[model samples]
Target: MSALPNTHEVLLRNLNLVEGRPALLGVSDAGLLPECPVPGLAMTEHAGLWQSLAGDTVWEGCYGYEPEPSQGGSYDTVVVFLPKARAEFELRLALARYLAAPGAVLLVIGEKKEGIAGAIKQFSAVAGDVVKVDSARHCQVWSGRNVDALSRFRLADWLDWSRVDCAGVELSVAGLPGVFSVGRLDDGTRLLLETLAESPLTADRVLDFACGAGVIGAWLHGFRRVSGGSPIRVDGIEVQAQAVFSARQTYLNAGVSGDIFAADGLAAIKESWPAVVSNPPFHSGVKTDTSMTEQFLSQVARHLAPGGELRLVANSFLPYEALIRRYVGPVEKLAQNRRFTVYRAVRKTLG
Candidate 1:
């Protein structure tokens, strides 16, 4: 296994603080905790991490993309690996608090650049008595004590929703912290929506890959309703549990008929669709990582119905045209502006 991240390493530096059963929250790295007599629970919002740890012998409990805490406030030690989004820390803190027992050793570990210091400050306001436990590898581990508190965690409570106009249709978009373009419609997505609005696709069923907050899918549904396009069944695939939850909320509130689920890229999808639309993500954390999107480009052809098309929006600078042409079929640039470009590729039909 690769070496533990600096934040996780700092968390290990103060392993002595662990009490009874332990709970790890927002821990992106798997296998960080050693095997204990009582196997601990490891949970993450990232589907990739959960997939790695699930069914493993070390952790008795593993949950991914689940908002509810399965083990109620039972662990005496709770460690929260800080997330990059400032508001997301509160959501993780709420989860950590719900999982930890009264007087549990609550540890928050993260790199300085990820805003660990600010996280502790905000955590101190709620639970109080926050302290720095350890510092190493440009990361710090902070500790706090959990209060005796029990309130059912409602994912809806954390969502921030807003009404935005896309394709001349007013649609509701809800997003949790860390979800892409949470409160506002991003330029790329807006551009894609406008282009699609002008010439709506003929697909009866649509799959929104990497759909964040279901904006693309929801807007399409509303536009079709007003403009008399073919009715579409929307299916969204998101990698983050938070994004999945938010996307579901967006669809629910907007009266958009859709299903949104968490998955690592396109791994969970099997059925082919008439059209696949996306503003596919290309970042892992704050870093630009294109492997996932490239993988999607590579495998999407198999998931397309005969003569089906893939419509997507990406940054203007990304080199996805070659990959799309190589994998799907002939590619056409539909729209382009200063920051983003929209492309469409159709799967070739057999004679």
Candidate 2:
């Protein structure tokens, strides 16, 4: 197998043999459980990571926002593998406060590059006292005790909601901490919307792949209604459980109906569609990687009907054009600005 992540290695090294079971939060597949096998819950939001720990006890939270108690009992220890997003870090800290037993020791581990010191500082707000227990492999492990009452931080209080207007459409977007571009619309998405308006693309069934906050799907639903087009069905697939929740709320706020599922890319989707549109995520944590987007481009053709099209907006610097041609079919640039490019690729029909 592969090596353990630096943060996980540091965490394992510094963790003392505690008396009771410990909860593991945001621990990726590369992270191994303690050799003694604690009975507490191992939780993650990434479906890919959750599936990797198959046969192991793992709980998949909807967007990595909430934590469920183990066997309905409070945990004596809570260990958090810090996330790159500040909002997500705070959310997990809140979970730590909610699930941790009074005076329970909360352990947090993270790479310095991801701001371990800042995380420790944030932990101090809710924790009684936070201190670095160990530092190695460029990662630091901090420990604190839960002194605040559970009722102080509610799950609903962690969500950040706001109204955003995109291309004259007002959106009631609900963003869970750490979800991308949470309460506001991003520039890339705005560019995609502009291209969608000018393009000749029309479909009765559509897939909003990587549908963060369900903005694209909601906008499509509203556009069709105002344009006097036939009623359309939209389905969204997102990797983050929180994004899936936000997408559902976005649809509700817009008075539209759509099916949204939390999945690892298109792994959970089975149906072929006439159109697929996305402003796909290219970052995993603090690393800029195209593996997820590349995987989608390489396999997306199998999920598209003949003559169906895949329209996506991406960073102008990304080499998606070549990948699109290799797997999907001929691709054309629909629009381009200073930083973003929109492309449309049609699936070739077989004779």
Candidate 3:
């Protein structure tokens, strides 16, 4: 009845593949709750859907751990929608093996332009064989069968969770496939760090808005930590479940304490704070969702402390400065590159 987001490939695959067959759906985007028009058998990770679907489900990403048994998921077939990241694809394949029952079928589908054909090489390692289905609308479908009698999801073997340094910031990160920045710091994030106006975070609690892998927060953890751990206790909020997990790992590895939660930006960040920094999330769920960044700015006025600062990075082409001015006091451009711009805003009483 309700509308669905841009992860239509999952929808299309579900419609084309599942025909009253019991199946388990492991998705990062919880928005898939509404699309189950006629639910036969599906377990979703998005928590909002669990109440309606009758299960104890939690919203989470593929890293960290696998979902527990619920309803038809036991002894049922599983289909994994390939994620955008190559590392994630590898991770999902391993998860799929764990989901497959004896003689269970694990089907995967993705867009042709996204290099699904190349993924066959990796899938073959886990599945005995990979079969291709029909292709339409620039998308391709592939199916793999797991015949392993003693099947266990190989999560540990797929990833190497280790401590690494990025630009002098040392932290431990479980950089799984499909996570933001894979195993290293993103260039945009580095640019944002450089652009952020140096405000002593030790004064008050800080916020790392849209923190991916907690790189900025990790770096700030050591910056001027007088006796206590950090001058400002950092909180990172990210929309992606996998991103938040990575951030948590980064925080733990860096010996920093920060809260990383999976929440829609405004709703998750509705609570007030004094200082905020970010490389605002621009890519929508499988689509371009500038509204999220736009909404974050529009609502930042209400949640921030008076005279608090908003520092962030975004593509230079985005019309965010005007949007920032609409909510906060003024926008100051600290730095610019070919593709992005870092902006600073201070909270001011609206006239």
On lDDT, the candidate that comes out on top is 1
CA lDDT scores, all candidates in order: 0.81, 0.78, 0.63
What's the C-alpha lDDT at position 58 in model 1? 67
Query: Candidate 1 or 3, higher lDDT?
Result: 1
Report the number of the highest-TM-score candidate.
1
In model 3, pairs of residues that clash are 87-177, 88-177, 88-178, 202-231
lDDT of 2 by residue, 1-351 (tens): 678888767766765734487777787763566443555667777767666655565432223655544422377888888887876887788777777788888888888998888878888888877887888999888888878737445455755777866655666777887789987889999989878767735888899999988888888777777777777788898877678777787787787666887789776678899999989988877678999999998778889999999999999999999999888899999889999999999997644
Residue-level lDDT of model 3, residues 198-250, one tens digit each, is: 43343357788777677788777765453254355788877555566667776
Question: Compared with the true structure, what per-residue lDDT tens digits does model 1 show for residues 1-351?
Answer: 789778777767777877888888777766575633446888887777777776677675455324445677778888888887887888788877777777787888888888877787878976778888778899888778886445567667777878898767998788788788888988999999988987788887899999988998888889889987777788999888888888888888878877886788776678889899989887877899889899999889888998899998999999999999988898999999989999999987533
Q: Predictions ranked by lDDT, top down?
A: 1, 2, 3
In order of listing, the candidates' clash counts read 0, 3, 4
TM-score preference between candidates 1 and 2, better one: 1
Report the error of model 2 at residue 299, Å.
0.9
Q: Which ten residues in a row have the lowest lDDT in candidate 2?
A: 54-63
For each candidate, give its TM-score against the true structure: 0.94, 0.92, 0.80
Q: How many angstroms is residue 287 displaced in model 3 relative to the true structure, after the best TM-score fit?
A: 6.2
Off by over 4 Å in 2: 34-36, 52-63, 69-73, 151-154
Q: Which is superior by lDDT, 2 or 3? A: 2
